[model samples]
Target chain A: MKKGTMTLTALLACVTLAGSALAFGLGDAIGGAAKVWEKKDAVVKAGKAIRKGTQDLTPSEEHFIGRSVAATILARYKRLNDPKRTDYVNRVGLYLTRFSDRPETFGGYHFLLLDAPNEVNAFAAPGGFIFVTSGLLAKVKSEEELAAVLAHEIAHVTLRHGLEAIKSSNLTSAFTIIGTEAVKEYSGSQLASLTEAFSGSIDDIVNKMVMSGYSQSQEFDADAEAMAIAFRAGYDPAGLTGFLTSLRDAAKGAPDTGFFKTHPPAGERLTKATSVAKQKKLTGAAAPARDKRFGGYKL
Target chain B: MNKSFWTVCGALLATAAVAWAASTVTVSVKQTSVRSDRQFFAPTVATAKYQDKLAVSGQKGDWYEVTVNGKKGYVHASAVGGGAGKKEGSSIFDDDSKEPGKEDVALAGKGFNPQVEKEYKSKNPKLDFAAVDAMEKITVSDAALATFASQGNLSPKGGN
Candidate 1:
């Protein structure tokens, strides 16, 4: 009877151990299923977010895009390599930046004079990179006029008009790919696709800035904002009107290239800028000393 | 064993919760003045240098209220990274140790950066990256700008 009882006890112990092992296996299976479900849910959510246009380009992304765009612009036009003139333009641009809405960006503000003669145009790339043609520089007679032009370009940078010029479809694809990738390092194909998207986006912006130009409304808005920025900076807001009027007059004599081609009609811009200046009651004037310094830089 | 696991998880969650309550931002510009108010014309209260870390306490429009060295001040959102001190992502079971996303990677200067620029240059040899490089080297000091403003009768001191 004692032997039988001991065997029975040993059998019960084995059964208990087996039962616990089965339960542990079941628990692990459930945990693994839950983990798979969680990962799937995250991916679905990320996809949905991309579909909803919730992804916005970060500042650093904008900086990179701007660098590429700037490179493209530089490819077309050589930079005017005058240290004195560059320094002067930078000083004027930097002073306006202090009073502008966005005083700083990821890469900081830079002003470059493009060596394009008889092309009255100014371009503002993303990340506070600005380009002014020598033609526009030669056209402005006073420091306030230069300030006004720089302020307009600065407004474009601050409002991200250049970035906005990128095609929406390109941005969506780029953002979607970026959002869906969980790993920092992309595979060979992934990097290829990303580079393709990036180049396409850059092309879109270049086309808008150099070829098609921004919309009428965007130019009008920049003009309006320029007036406000110049007023706040103590520069005569009428300087924008003065610059636009000069452009209109110059258009009659010169070929319709650069500014005349890329921007809206100067008469419309001048009218709008004039109205804004009047509404704001801007009465500042260009100091003679300021103009003297501006004149010191030779074209 | 399960009890200890849950305890550790709970502690981590609590720490993350606290960290979320007060976000931190790093200054990205060379030097940014912490204004006494949100507007640009407001008085300068303190100066924050590049890479200076500040604990964000509140926000008003484009400016963020931050504390550095036990002093309260406001810095424009553009002057710091993580624009306005916004937290990127958060979830109960989210793994913070995972590799960063594209946005974070770009901000950290990892992917699609100088390396990519070099690659792009190799492909498009006509692009004038040397001029862009020179353009990037230009720097303007605050003192110089102030003097320029004063000389030109511009804003802040020119009595706009």
Candidate 2:
């Protein structure tokens, strides 16, 4: 009897995941397959499925969630507001995004320089809202490193990493109402329910972004993706390795918030990046035009 | 059958076959660039707006070769929602094939959009959307970005 119930639970779980039908990359579903998100009160949930949990949210919905997350982050960290620097970063970041796995997002990619010079953190909200801290800018020795950093965050967005942070239970509520009918507007109760789910979605993401770090595997995945994206965009993969090497020493006096607190560099991550860097041929002239332009921007 | 009658039938069938072979796709995103090349940053040949029907052919990975208003170009498959005779294959990324009258209802401003943002903002006054608005304005033109990449010797690989 217990075996039959177990089989029944697995069947229903598969049915729920199949209902999501994400469009971009199906392979992600496999990696995320173990991530079967159950209803908040669902007692019989297990495994690690990725995009399926948040599959009900449209690209536009993802954008709104990201926009709010950006709002929250911007509220905490003010913009530096130097057009030249901001424009430069945007160009570089946007250019790298073209080479990332998922390039064209609903709202497209946008990058901003946060004013916190002491916090060496960067963030990539869903739907391509990227934030780079002045402190992170100060840390990079060259434009390649900057590209590497941006590429890492782009990987997060391209991989829908932020969306993955939405707790499955929250998704259960959001998915329950979306697309069930072709109504132009949700009824008041439905809207309220969705809004609560929306509010919780942001809470889950903000908590992950501000308090805890991504799973070490996710960080590693981002690092590996950063190398591929940077190399494709003609920046050397070494940039990531160089930055990771520097990050190892940063944990000593790391601040309470931002990259250091959330992303404590692991030795294994750096070693993996270093090996990958060695395999990728240095793609472009690093010193002359690139680093020279890097000098033009003020941290 | 007589030769002339047979010839007429062949002509009609040929024309029907041509029409049947032709596939159609509708742009599903707010906008998608029809590029000279399949590369995302390749030069934009044209822009397809939401619900714009396109004559399409060939598929290289996720991009569809499309002809828009006498111009030939390629659009990423994700940019278009449905193919000819394909109705059931829709994903969250797609808001495909709505009824004609209902098209306007789901048009660019549907789902969690500006209205939701406004509502959410009224409730949470401390969140700085004004900053996000200002941040969204930060943009680089294609010409400027191309120049930035070429000048810096950075944008060398995949981008056109």
Candidate 3:
């Protein structure tokens, strides 16, 4: 009887020891899993940080911003319904794009004719959307002059002038919000604030392009770039000077509005554009064939 | 423990591999000519169209030397995306009816994107998106551009 009791006690002791060992083994496995998850979490966090902290907006973001801006402008002016004329503008615009430093945007370059007969203005939105008022088109005497106008607008897009017009403080705040909200989803309030920042950014650009116009320096830079681009595209660089000369003549006849209000004095612009053309020795003449095509389409 | 360590190592290695493989660029424009030299006025050797994947064998300033269909030439860097056909970011405001979930919100936080545009559109319903859509549909073919350039006496002759 004493041996039997001793054997039973030994068996119970073995069972308790084995059970505790199994429990310890399970705990180790769980701990290992937790460590792996922690490492993965860290990696994801780092990835998010990198994405949020990026300084410049990506091509996709630029595209969306430009699209919204284009929509806003279209809201104000009716698009010209003449497909033939519109196609002509696009062809010239696309040809010049080949010579631009940045020829491609996310949505590609598009040219539209606005039916603002009295407004002699051309505007470029981000993402390569360009608009020229019919009044400006009518003022252009030759195809090369039209190319010059389109090239100027294209220069604005390539140089990101519209994006630069946004207030620095607004951009900083928006970027900060983006960086802080690193998670895949934002709360309701966070989204609301982001939307507000976006609206402010759009407002800044609109005010600059429409109400106030870009600074004198920016306009001059675009004019210089346009001359270079038009020269490269085999158009007469003097086309810009000719267009400005016409504007100067017209401004003398009528009150300053639209293009005159938005851009620097035509006299100053003509001098600058002519100097640039002369310095580059871009003396190419407008092709007769291009003029023929230009004449086929009635503005 | 060993399995987890291998998994983590594998994930890291994959990320590194992607960075290393970024030498390839895909044409993003509708079409662009690959020139014998970096300059736009240089002789043309071949032409690449949209989504045509090319290996970026070399780079000079803003131009990239690409190999397409066994032929090597220089293409402007602006004509192609830096990496393969990979696009960054996720769809944030793809569908306006549904409330965006966490994943969508995260992507939207990347920058001002389609989601923000949707919200802006909602507030300003008068904006003419239809006209914008029509404008986006307008595309000039490369052949037409080439013809125009040649007739207009632009550089890089059409045949070459």
Candidate 4:
């Protein structure tokens, strides 16, 4: 109860401070301040929304945040050294991005193969720093299936799922710090606070990507978008269904650990994804060439 | 006071609002290519960076057709935000949204940039950023990508 009032007070303060920034419009007053003030009532509501953490981070910011998360994940896992496999995975991942809504990310999309031969999962750090484990790669039986998995990871990135994991309080504090006008450089105190918030944000995202997993709804959304992207990219939508079917079989009686532990039951995911495929009429046949390449790149 | 006068006033305000919604856009990405065409594989005509405001003359799909330094090109909509702000490289501000606080990272270069990363890295030496750098280095060239697509019998036309 005490925390609730404190939050409200802090939020009100955020609104107040944000309003003051409008006075000078932060050194670059290209947009008319007069026009801005004319809609002060609406602006305040927007400020309230921002103060409540309903804000979007720029692509550059997401890139920086993603790098740290990628670094953290790297600290926990080892990268695969097979240049052939790594190059092959990157080629597939990058090709998929050209067909995603957010094809062009601030730092561009990069795919890293993690040498987790026993861990069947993938991680899409905010921007496009995506990591796919070797065990998961072993599960894929075709180029279309591989594309299906990558399309899902790319969907996660394009959807900004990791940022959704950031705590709103941390975002509010960061907004307060950077949304100031005389902010050429972070003062020592400001830097400390901002760093603390930034560090916390990273922790939040990494926790979601690792250890625990995104909510079931998030997973389903990714699956839906993945199928859409796969269909648009000229791959058989059955690729997603096939991949999900494989997981459902592999996960039967599997211990509640690793991928199976963090994600929804593959059975449930497959059901919903198949339904979506039917609705979208997502029909296509795997090209013989694609199957051949998949056989060649088989790890 | 009269109906025609009120109509004229309303028309002017509506025109102003439309102009305001699509005038100036600030760069949101660290850097984005202003391409000859609205596709990633298109040739880059100009380069814009974080906080650099560009004139958003028009929009094509998700790509914003912008002119910076009189050179016309296209920037992805995700690479920019805000409106009605003139930027000469150094200026960074957001007055685009009628709602205050719509743009949070205009001070991004000063915000969570490399400097912050350096600080964070120093504090967290246990993190393996070297591996991250190695992962980042795994890039696909246009030639390699084209070949991969061709070999796979895939023809990716692009998306949102």
Candidate of highest DockQ: 4
Better of 1 and 4 by TM-score: 4
Per-model TM-score of chain A alone? Answer: 0.81, 0.79, 0.81, 0.83
DockQ of every model listed? 0.17, 0.17, 0.16, 0.29
User: Candidate 1 or 4, higher DockQ?
Assistant: 4
The better candidate by TM-score, 2 or 4, is 4
Q: Across residues A142-214, which tens digit of lDDT does each residue of candidate 1 receive?
A: 8888989999999888767887777777767766666666555666776666777677778888899889899
lDDT digits (tens) for residues A1-299 of candidate 4: 58668666655654454344432233223246865565464444433334334235656667889999999989998888889888888888898887777766667889988999998999999889999999999999998999899999999887778888999888888777766524546778888888888999999999998879999999999999998888877788789889888999999877787788779999999999989989988878899998887888787
Pick the winner on lDDT between candidates 2 and 4: 4
Predictions ranked by TM-score, top down?
A: 4, 2, 1, 3
lDDT of 2 by residue, A1-299 (tens): 58668666655554444433322112222333343232211211111121145643555567788999999998898899788888889999988877765666667789999998888889988878999999999999889889999999998886777888999887776655553424546677877776777788888898888789788878888988898888778887778877877887776666556776787464678987776656665444465888788888846
Computed on alpha carbons, the lDDT of every model, listed in order, comes to: 0.69, 0.68, 0.70, 0.74
Over 4 Å off in model 1, which ranges? A1-55, B1-23, B26-53, B57-62, B69-73, B81-112, B157-160
lDDT score, residue B140, model 3? 87
lDDT of 1 at A251: 76
DockQ-sorted candidate list, best first = 4, 1, 2, 3
lDDT of 3 by residue, B13-66 (tens): 453343223335555555678888776556678988755666655555667777
